[model samples]
Target: MLVKAFDKNIRQNKTTTINTNFVVIGGGTAGVCAAITAARQGTKTVLIQDRPVLGGNASSEVRLWILGATSHMGNNNRWSREGGVMDEILVENLYRNKEGNAVIFDTVLLEKVLEEENITLLLNTSVYDVKKSSDTKIESVQAFNSQNSTEYVIKSPIFCDASGDGIVAFKAGASFRMGAETKEEFGEQFAPDKSYGELLGHSMYFYSKNTNKPVKYVAPKYALKDITAIPRYKAIGKGDKGCRFWWFEYGGRHDTIHETEEIKYELWKVIYGVWDYIKNSGEFEDVDNMTLEWVGTVPGKRESRRFEGLYMMTQQDIIEQRQFDDAIAFGGWAIDLHPADGVYSELSGCTQWHSKGIYDIPYRSFVSKDIDNLFLAGRIISATHVAFGSTRVMATTGFCAQAVGMAASICVDKNLKPADLLEKGEIKNLQNELNKLGQSIPNVPINKSSNLINEATINASSILNLNQIPYNGDWFSLSISAAQMLPFKANQNYKFKVLVKAEETTTLQVDLRTSIKSKNYAPEVILETQNFNLEKGEQYIEISFSNPVPNNQYGFVTFLSNKHASLKTSNNRYTGVLSVFNGVNKAVSNNGKQTPPDNIGVDTFEFWTPHRRPDGQNIAMDISPAIEAFNADNIGNGFVRPYGTTNAWVANLNDKNPSLKIEWDSEKELSEIKLFLDPDYDHPLESTLMGHPEEVAPFCVRNYTITDLQGTILAKKEGNYQTINTWKFDSKIKTKGIIIEAEHPSVNVPASIFEIICS
Candidate 1:
């Protein structure tokens, strides 16, 4: 509502009021992630950035890689792609234009916020003061932009300050501290022998390609007498001069930490001088032609303010890999420390690298010890210097953002505060929510292999490390009551199968759910089967879906539900039609190994479409008998159509039979079928349709001819003719896209074919 009015008196002009549910203070890495998370979870989130853009140091301003905890993969710790926002950005980088992690830091960061609809981003906005109710309870915040003298007020139930400096916490009277702590503070062994005020200096980095290109080496004007001989610690490998850490490169060591503005001013001179030395040395034919891509306006900050929280994360917690009930995220970055003294000083000592085992951060890291709703994210969370050294990375910060957002959601939904959820009972549900989004927390069963839901499948997962859990013999027991949420096709048939491999006699109880029902949908589950006890390897079973399958409604929109997450429709449509058991879509097919069945002592939920295949006379996905297990539901990203995928609908079935189903029309085509057997969660295989679609054209009689993705005749065969029979052919291919294309004989006129059969 815009009101056109004139103020009679300039001094009596009334200001406008702004309100939001979640007001995040800083717009750094964690702040962005937190705001995105909250918005994704259906919250009214507002992110206030004092700077022009969201990223603090890791943006165009600083130009730093968002490193997670170290990996044991190489010299550095492995990168965890399971992290959502961080992983999304990294994956997008892989897809976008990039030579070698040459990050387009700012644009990608902006895309993430824009993708989420619930978040409101504020740039060039600074939080100046806090309006607390009575005695330290913040009622609202006053923000002022220096560019414009006008000030604004922001009110919210929950707030997250992902600022590296604990900006909001300081303003809100929340307890916080800066600089390194004494050894006695947290009993950290890595603290300096005598705690000093010195901190890890910041870096004003610059990027250029082909640093190893032939160039004459001439020392800068300020270079020491024996600068080339100085010991250099390589932060980045592959023989680059800028890869060197320490020595402050061009600025004083203390310049990076205390006087950032001064350091920014000094770095330009140093970089130019270095380049001048190279140019004056007659390094190249065109020394003047060299290009400088970036000069960091935002200094790469290491240590800042550490806010006080209910539970201060410590190094002991990391060394022991301690599991907490409120676990929100994990980090394994080494504790890298730096010195405090200026250049040419031999007496500067700092701490780095605590232990080999990484650390687990609890939800307590987000909450301030003194504030009710204020949460801290990014490097300012309540972590000891050593532990902060690890969790401070951008990837780990994303996890905190995701976790704190869930907590904030709980606070809003349940009308509780951050402190209330920090206690034992309140945080369990929030942690569970984080686990589904792939947060690294203890006791959250990850990667469980389900043998009870599908036949021909081995319950296996890396997170579970199945090899360590001794196997048992005679694992092929027929299943009962195992639920599954798979892709179901209307009027199609499928077979569910599972094979349990155990070396010893063991009792395996797997809970499964092949169907979900709320106010709008009903149980479309025609079969919920399970099996028990097989050998240590391959098993076979099949459940058919030829009956009147269930297809209630493809899209259901619930506006009154929790946060109104589904956006397509309201009234979660319950179309009482049998799901197409057999259809012509890749995801509508019956079977192949996808996700490992969840049967880890009843703490996991997992399901997937039997390698869905979308092309054929009747593209169907089926498997053998269900592995004896537990509850299950539809496995999906929860959208009728999601980005980077085909338009499809997921179906859930519950029964003891290995039957799969799907729904499709003339949208695309019925050509080649595909089966994606994903053993590694990171990369799933795209192969022919379970070796069965290859041997049979789904639309063939007893005779069969198959084509590949390019419509090339890969195989041809002749046999008997039948209509009401089903045939099964096991797949044995070591490639992706296990396609089973229907061979069309161009030798004659175009022939119409439907209702494929093989038995």
Candidate 2:
């Protein structure tokens, strides 16, 4: 063996230059996702992270659990699962690390970026300086790697600033802001009355475990002296960890970016003090075997400098649920605002306000208005303080990152600037591409140009007849049953079916009603009523009527409770439907006895057990064409709700070899096919606040086969777990039609498909 001797006195500074199509700064969830999206689209990309580990706040350094649409299981928003790269990361996390280990999650994020062939990942690389072609566009960026003593000059056609603090955009002279806005600025009601330069604070979290042996902790000199100073100390319990300490924040009245060190020290004192209180204080009894397993050295920041873009989303847009023409992403988390003083404040920890449903985030919010080549993602995207309160979450930021990355790839291929893509009316093309890649944009239909179903004559072997499932066994009292309030237009006659169970011979009265005002949830007006005689068991009844509805109204159905009768309910409910109930009064039965509402106002949708009428007569076997599974709109609509709705195309359970066939007008060149299947979003993704043990849903497609018009088998897949499946052929083949045969995960359940596209 030969031993090589190295010279200790040698000193050298190495500089490296790399060119790529896109350059991404800050390898947080947004940066990692943006890089992956671009690389997967065949664009050469570079991802630079200041920290050594990936996932930023979600890493072991911070240990903040990734939360978005679900809003930490707050029980407000529904059907709000994040799509695109964030979905992939989450599904993978659930499958691989069921235990929700932070260390394993870090590896998962790292592996995703590393696996992309076109991506160049530089960990522990800090981008400090940027070069500009003019005052309007970024030309290159210079980053330093302290670990290797190297300087990297990265040149790219387009650059994304996902640094969370907008570092690249700031250095490149992009217009930005760093404070809360006044109420009159954007007509935002949630804005502070007096303008202030305060950002959401930074926080540190710790984990504790029981070791079966007594562990003692000695307080440091800088530890907080009195735990009584913090009013939220009651939240600290024996099993609390990670996100459970979201309120352990500080440094909001200071510069979040420049004063990060001071913030970290302040948070450290509080964390140690809190732990000291738990260990040394006599308040806790079971701590004899409990010890601090890990504490975060870095403070996870919430808000910082935000870049200015073509459009600045305001609080009114969120509250009004404004639908933007160029919506690329959606957010449903409430407008959660923390006190500026953080833990030191005497006021409550935070305030949250919810919308009726998820709201749209436009593409204009992701591109800089002045910086021609600069794009933004993460918390630094162009949004007012009130709007950022909801969009700043990791999952929403990841979707924004995916959108920017996809747009950057389009810009490179079209040889256009970021703003040009919008001004030239080319955003539709970008949106269509995103849809093909399984990114869901509410209200936007699938790309018609690529979906063969749009041009072909589509038919299915058997349509799913949801009415066949009889309404029996369970009966909820009308007074205590939570019914969803749907928006109804005036003078439009509509028919709906409901199942009524009668214990004795009696007359049942049902009334259609509406709320008195948009602000109130109580019903005040009865539009119409139908009286029916019921004998016994469950009987399906149809009600038809037309009435004038007030402007901006919520329509609901109420039934006068009969002592012997009850309304039947389906096992599942649809999204966007609100459960109508009295927050002030408890529900009372006919016997004058109080009973809890079967489905609370929190998680109820359509409660009426109704199905489509077939053959112009009320029959369960004959499926109506309007709600048939083969309807093209059912497969093209971007919305995927829970089963038992018209949004999804479902095949009957009895169809042994059911298949969907698309016959094109003529032979066309096809290379790829993409399918979006149901993932059972109603099933909570996380078992607890941490995460769920199982990653994949049982509702997802398990086995499927695709065949061409000539009966030539094109492909076959088995035991599928992913929500989106993309299949590519060895070469483009000319085919007039394609047939897809899918089997359900279980024999008695129907197979559901959301959307399908071919390109």
Candidate 3:
């Protein structure tokens, strides 16, 4: 090392310039996804992250779990996990870090980005200035890294601003909103008033550990001494840690970006003050052995500047479940909001209201209205404050950002700007490309013209009849009304036989119900009711509705609550099949129902949600006429996931060697084949703190082989746990037909495939 003397008290740092096709700012969930997805789509991408690690709020520094449509399984959106790159990250995290260690999750994201050869990751770099080629286009960005004392100039044709605070968009002079809109502005009844607060706050979390031996703790001088100042300090608990303290928030009233450091200090005071109370106050016990293991140095920010785009999504778009022609992504999380006062407020921590189904997110919401080359993503995307409550979740933001990545690739290819893709055909092309990558838009199916499998005849060795779920000696009491949501065929008669046990003679009422809307999972419409008188002992009981299903949709076979009755449950769980209860998740419901204020632009409905694994077992029952939705012909239906119907082809549980064959009239050359498998989309894969029970989804195919006409294996994979599998041959494989053989991930669960494409 050499020391240099400064002349005239002037010094300079090394500077570098990099050229890329696309640039993604802030390596949070959205930016990481945008960069990875664009790189995978053949665009050279540069990812700039100010933090040392990727995964902004979800990183080990913040440790907030990644949750989206499957809102901790607290809502009725079934099979609603965000797909594409986000799904891959979550699935990989579940497989490797089911314990939900935040450090491991960080590694998962880093590995994903590193694996993509087209992505160049720059960590510990912050953008301080932006260069504009024109009033409407961004030419480059200037970033600096203090770690290496270097300045960087990155140039790109397209730029995506996924930074939570909207740094690039703000510096680029993009129009944006920082607070709530008036009720008259968008006819939004749920808009927060000035007194109630206009913005959600920032939060920090701490973790505690038990030391078998006693440990002492001392409060710092800066720690707050008064804990009772918080309105809900009694809600704190000994077992609570990390995200449980999501209410320990502040700084929403101040400018979130400029005053971030100040807000972090306030959060720190609250966190340490709360800990001091827990240790010193007489209210808690066994505290001598407890010690703080980790404390968040940086607070997780919730909201800031929402940039303007062609379309500003409002509360109506979410509540109405509106479909957009240029839809490229979907979100199902409830419209959740919090008061500006945060933990010190007298109001509850949050107010959440859910929609009946998932809603579409338009491409227009991501493209900047003023800047032609800028793509908005994450919580900074174009949306009213009322709508941001639902769209701000990490997974949902990442899903929308994936669409921006695909759009960026197309823009680079066509030498066009982001807004140029708004043309009908261009948007459709973007949608089709996203679907091919396993991202399913609401009510949108893959185009048939793009897949060669649609032109051939398909058959499977055996299709699952789904006649019965064998009992596993597990009995669950009917503490509340329970129902099995079954995908039933149109105009089909149904009868069920279930094993029941009663401590005393009880009257059991069985009702068949369906949703008023075909795509909804809520059981609101009662088709028929049947009453049965049961004896005191365990026995088999049969209930017949007599009425056939009116349409091809999911029907609920309900068993009303009886204090002395219990029903048998089975371990066999299948895709598009779940048992729900008429109960409250408390997180999204108020006493088993959503009773919003009249004319508040929200609905009143009961929540029917499924239980997590090792608990919400399927009801053991036998049906007279088997459900006919699981047929071999479904492989070519173009739908990759469950919609109004189960679009998957499921194999018989008894069939050991399940195989699907695609045949053509003459030999055809194919170089690539793709298969879409079921990964139990209903399960919420929270990235950190929320531990899962399984290493791989039970519905995933564990082993599979692809063979040609000569019975020679072209591709073979074992221990598979992903949703999308692709096979590319070094040379063309010419054959009249191709066969795919797969083994079920679980013995009780059958092997299933959503769609197969060959080209």
Candidate 4:
């Protein structure tokens, strides 16, 4: 090829236009979820991202751990991990990358997007302009990919704005708020003031590794010269890396969007300065062999330009745990806020205020108030600043974005706007659709319309009868108070017996506790207390309680802490039983109890959380008149997760072959069968840094087979490790009855199923 002389007129880059049913801007967690969900729901979708990678803050570039409800098991929100597509991705990541490598996580997100045939993903593409069909509707958007030197104009009927900076919404003239709102605006007593901070800031992280040999480093000219300028400089240690220094931040005082570059420079200076002190300051040892392995180029952004929607979620809604008729999603993270000065400020890095329990998110919060075709997601959803502090986490953002995705699909099918779904009879349809997709909405049961199982009689080979947890020779000291959470029926008198040992003669106190609300897990109401005098040697002691059980719910059989006593624990873990301790998880709670300032619109309570796997063994105990919650009838209850009671059908532990049989009055054609299994929702599937202990949920059924009344095998599944498993037959089968034979994943745990549906 020969080069010619440059002409006066310039040549334009290649341009392309694509038309689709839906468009999601910003390929962060929210955008990834929205685009994937819409595509799965039979909609043609396009996902656009300005960066080369997907996950916004959770990507390898930023490397912040993704979390939502079940916040590090720090609070009382048990079995609260998000469900549906977000759950699928988290579970899959845990199965593949339990080590939590950030680069490996990037591949997981890419694979999920690529697997969806209906989705089109564009990376390193930035949307610079927006085109509107009318004053109130966006028609298309203009974007350019720097890597390819290409311009793209994408047109869609519905659009979702999940960009961290609200780029598309801002260009489309959507109303938004940048800083914290005044207390009077939303009656938010916990709202931050001018001195406290108006917005949460940006943060960058660096990872360090040991070379095992001597290494040297020299600071560049731009590196910070003074480490003493940072008030918390002494808090930095030699071995600290990544989010261990999440407080190492800046850029809250300036414009977070336009001044991002300036903010990034400040963060880099702080990081390099911190590293320089760790290396050559001679204040620490063992760091001579350590070097910086990776540094974040893009800072993880917390908040900016929250766009307005139909309804603005406020602090009162979260604190009160208010129920909404249009509820579509849920959130449980604490209301966490940081200082404007970031790491340089003398104040603590964050202030987290947790509610008593999880709260519902309404569908209105995802819909635009002015723009007819616009949908808002992620940190841009409508909410007051105080409420945004809790809802801004990645998992919460991703779950709410799922609602937006499904709403977009419905809008395309019915030719209706987002507001149309909020009408009296239409909201339930949306909820029903979400339930069908495996989303566990708080207080929302699965809708059963055309399900064939609803008209059949269900029977199991053996239902779990609560009796005893055999001792495994493992003993735990009673240095802290421990409680066993078990399902108790209404108007029942229960007796519990446990093996106890005392170094000296001690008086052990046992109390029966329950939550004031039936659905909540917090044990605030003490029903009864009993004191038993124990001898110096190990012996079995029994306690009886006849307190009034208001309704069927999980009650806490608590054994108060005794310094001179110890109790036996069992390795026989059940599907719905858990043991908790009144202890502190310094990440979320400073002390074992939460005591807030008076009238701050937050609650004060004790945190009773379970220990992680290989440690959280069940209390060995025997009960008379065992719990009857796990029956075959529970399979048709329409609930797939534990609420006030265990909504699962668990077989007896000793049953070698557990099976379920469903019989109808007459033969009916069935095309598909779906089974919802147990996934141990108590485990918080953090994307990175916090690695999980198990690849597959220990309570899941590994193998199962379905057969008709004539004993002909219809479908079989092996090595199953997911929450939902579906069997679609090539042709409709006419059968009067069907039987499901399943095997437990482990001998310690029994086979359990939450729901079964056939159509």
Candidate 5:
């Protein structure tokens, strides 16, 4: 039954005025981080999201998995986790919603924004009008709340355009560019020879489920006829679901923003057509119960209008691994470029080019050169199209948002513009503050002068006594020999050990080399060489140097062309260690047959190791009094990558109850303690995929207790999920020494601590 009510009432339109210190437009991943950072920093912030839900493409409407430095676990990115806010979001999602439910993930984003006291969140609001103080700066923005039909004029001293389309920057008449730049313009080798106005198109994804009973899908009148026209139709499998149809894209040659409606309609047809083919094609087996559960209405857009900033990132900067002094963020995803034709193109889905390692992103790329008060984040940040391919991922964009938000807060405090902050040499101040806030800036350490841990006498339960984790099992020699490198601090005594497995009696030759240049991974200078005759089975050989290692040097151990013997390797690779397979690429096929070169260089494997310990501990090149973990240098040594074992402090296995003790020369008042734990970077944080069994890594301290020297309990927490844990006292307490008892959930690994700070 339908009920109707008749009322004689007159309603008047309302206009509201809101003032804030910072206004962030768009509630996407970047905007969410930007708003939260600003509001948490005590700035009055207003976040205007066009859609009812946040997350933009990552929202339930268009389900694109958030990927960044990890690159969906591709390209040997073992320890590449985006730090700061992105890290928090990923860890929380993994802990709370490990099943990868999209509906639940939406609430995770919503709860975070609502928890910020200083942020005024306006959902279902679209900003269309911009009021500029002059041609050079923006004064305010006018937004319309479609749900309530209310007009809001939001005024702010600073504005960040994370709208993905750069709507505010465009409306403000800021200088920007659309489409690709010519190869000659930026000397980008990856760019097309001829420039085109076409951009990367839009895509729609759908989820399908299996029902107990048979279900049918009816093709709509507008459904695509003759699925044979799509060459990739054969690639779709029966079990595939949402986000798998990333290639189902269209509308690149057309205007993506203005012509979004037409694009959505075309995407709808393609989606239905693909589903019809999958269900009725008769090629799939045992899929009679499969039905389309959900299909996206909105298209996930890829490239659009990009704002021009003080510095434009180019492909060369990414490939060459350029280290910028003003680096505020980092990206390691491959340069993945899709054709302008998108799904219609006959070629493969995309072309990808990889760098040796991660690259740095500068702050200059996020601040506008033409618009003084405007900041750019997300996909719209200043970058050539070739470079944008790598920087466009959600996690990378989130980091950009974090940097912009921090910069905005600084601007509000200093009464300076975005460009003024950079010109006045305040970028270092921004970097220092970011480190303090747990943001990871490559190669930069947190400012140590103010850290109380620096003054304290640091000690731990036990220090690692082995060079590498022990390898007791039999390890056969590969067809080719290999080499491994270990990194150490300057002026340190070091001993190299290797476990040899000889099939028969054989002589093994080894060479030790040093890094030729600073900051380079490859070794060039040979330090020592030795040859030894080994018996069958396993033998432990140790080599000690008479002189202490020089400053900033890497010890490279190479097994020279040993065909009769293979060195025993540990199960996992440790930080500061690199294994090279005979210094040459191997050609092999699935059937274990030598194949022709595929042009891809397979240099090293992540879990392969050449050094071993007799104690069978999973140790990697560890050098420690264990006190370095409490040092301020651990805060941002840029060694967050999991396999890189340099920065973290590991407890010795001898202690039954591992504890870290800090003893001060004099009594000090302590109010708070900050602890950073290892969250298992090897695990990918994605809702669309099945996560690890444990919400928090077993290696992470599941239960921990903090106490004073007199045995008074300070604080205790159990089942912690976050990487960064902070315990604040009700009141400051005077203590000469403190003790931390951390219990590992698993017996296989010891408790690891990344950074510890006392305030």
Candidate 6:
């Protein structure tokens, strides 16, 4: 790949030619995201793009929406972090475009990457040739421009192919495939059962505007022909509508990336004639003066060279929802098929398949099936004709780019090749890091509604901090708005404390009602009633144990269908997956599959155990003080008194005494903390902190650990702890307070401590 050399006078600060850790080609949706990721990982990264601007189809040329994995199927649904940099784009769009839609989203995309200090983007450059010695690893890439050419001879420990086409992989001798393969190959339903000689053609998209005027009309000769002659084709828009996005057709199949100009030229002439035919016909009398808005010279190429990867995804993967240990990104687009001859037929030609939810894009599909260093992204990633139909969308491609970058970074950091990451011992870190950056390896639809706090319109999938801020839990109003509900049968209830102010408050009332319902499963309108509100102040309140229904059940427990009231096996929408967001657990799955108890509180949107009973004393939950210290206690320490010695709860650190002490050591610095119980949750006395048969334990546990006021430990005893022991902190320092949450023997406890510490 070639990038225009910097001007001779150009000198970036801290002039250091750091060894190139990663080399990413093709600055499209996937490429840019990959570059951003590698740079973010502190790697010396370079972004190579053949185009002048960033963004692939969503650029100034094609102009499409940057969809992320945030749009929910329900009314009160929330978004997730499935959108990495795209989230930043949406937030920027919300912040800048109060009206919401920005005409030139590409400029915004360019600005985002340019502002990042770690990334260096090279536009108006193309990859001409790559150099190699042993024929396995790339030594350096040589890029060129018309006027002058320069070779970036620096060693690239890792290489990523983010080009919309598998150009880099092709150059690096990576295996690849293209066109419709035999149905038996991937066992795709729509596949022709035999490999085809042709594949779908590319498109040059354009937009139009309707002025609602009157113009002399006349029907063209061909417009008079039978519309049903084409396969699955229709001539419905006899009038005017700005519906021209899919009104594209290709001329012939050749070099898509190179022949885009010629294809767009052919599409242009057809556009004028098609418009003339419409205006001349009496059918579109309502839209007389329909004018064209924008046209693209560079067409969005759908079908192109596909590089062979370790895992060539087939239609069966989508239908079966195959789960791989190295899953990375997800795709939700429908399987849209166009002819390779660039013709629109009504019968057996055009086909589409809507994905039930987000399907995982396996990690193997990203790297070459045979080549050592080559990795493919975008439309080039391995997918059967049918599977690619859905996986080739823009939002999905952007995430694929992020995965490519992450894998590249992993190779450089761990000193491994592309195949090694997948075939070698373990690449869990790469998978984990990619996931941390809004990528999914689950290959499942994401439902994060249960985990979000704020009602976001565009920004979806955000992490909810379990950390609570002091509040007077009065009025007791906590709501979860869902676009729809799911049918579930969880016998569990959430345990949380609400701090309420008692005086001047009376008449506690709570109401439950459905906001939306499905078409067939609407609630019976036998009686009419309204919901009631409670007083503004109450001392303490819980998710009512005595009340038959909790307010959250009305919304929290939504049916699969839009119907406000639907039952399981009612032909209702109980099969759609719903993701609830909670900081502790990133994802939970429920298809509204079963009917839950009428008395159960769906308010918490949680699953309960039958033995413990709903709202049971032993139930672990998120609780906070309802009232401020109006009349305080001078006690240095506070503890929750359990009913019996058999009902003990370990001290998960919340606030620590200045007099406590602790210590610990490990091979690597520990950033996160979690406890484990041994005997059983109900019996804390029999618990032990011993590593299982697994190769190694996660953290070093001490019999006692102490932290100063600043939250840093001063000392600790290395030993297995199993009791109601105060996992002490290093008390020698000073800061605020700390909490020592016991791990095992009790799995229900949630203890997370940060900040409050001593230097």
Displacement of residue 181 (Cα, Å) in model 5 is 0.6
Off by over 4 Å in 5: 1-12, 76-78, 193-198, 472-645
lDDT of every model, 2 decimals: 0.46, 0.73, 0.90, 0.89, 0.74, 0.45
Candidate 2 per-residue C-alpha lDDT over 1-759 given as tens digits, one digit per residue, 9 for 90 to 100: 997589788765799999999999998889988999999999999999999999888887887777776554342234467777787787777778766888888888999999999999999999999999898988999999999999999999899999988889999888999889876777766675432225789998888899977888898999998998888887679788876788899988988999999999999899889989998889988898888888888889999898899999988777666888889878876677788888987776776565545778999999999899999999999999989988998877887789899999999999999888878998888887776766777667566765766777777777764333333225666444344454444444546677777887888876777644442233456778778888788787776655644643445655665768776643332222233332221110112112223421122222121111110012121111122233445665554443123356677667888688878888988888878886644333431236663466655777999999788998889978777888988999899989999987665346777777777
When summed lDDT is taken over every stretch of 10 residues in candidate 4, the lowest stretch is 423-432
Q: Worst lDDT window (10 residues) for model 6?
A: 682-691
By TM-score: ranked, best first? 3, 4, 5, 2, 6, 1
Q: Candidate 4 or 6, higher TM-score?
A: 4
lDDT at 595, model 4: 93
Runs of candidate 1 with Cα error greater than 4 angstroms are 1-16, 75-79, 100-103, 146-150, 194-197, 209-258, 281-288, 342-354, 446-759
lDDT against true structure, model 6:
0.45
Candidate 3, 380: how far from true, in Å?
0.5
Looking at model 5, residue 170 earns an lDDT score of 95
Lowest lDDT 10-residue stretch of candidate 3: 583-592
- Best of the two (2, 3) by lDDT: 3
Question: Each model's TM-score, in the order given?
Answer: 0.56, 0.83, 0.98, 0.98, 0.84, 0.57
Sliding window of 10 residues with minimal summed lDDT for model 5: 585-594
Question: What would the TM-score be for candidate 4 when compared with the true structure?
Answer: 0.98
Cα RMSD for candidates in order: 19.4, 7.1, 1.3, 1.5, 5.6, 16.3
**Mind giving the per-residue lDDT tens digits that candidate 5 earns over 175-223?**
8888888767887756753332247889998898999999987889898
Candidate 2: clashing pairs of residues: none
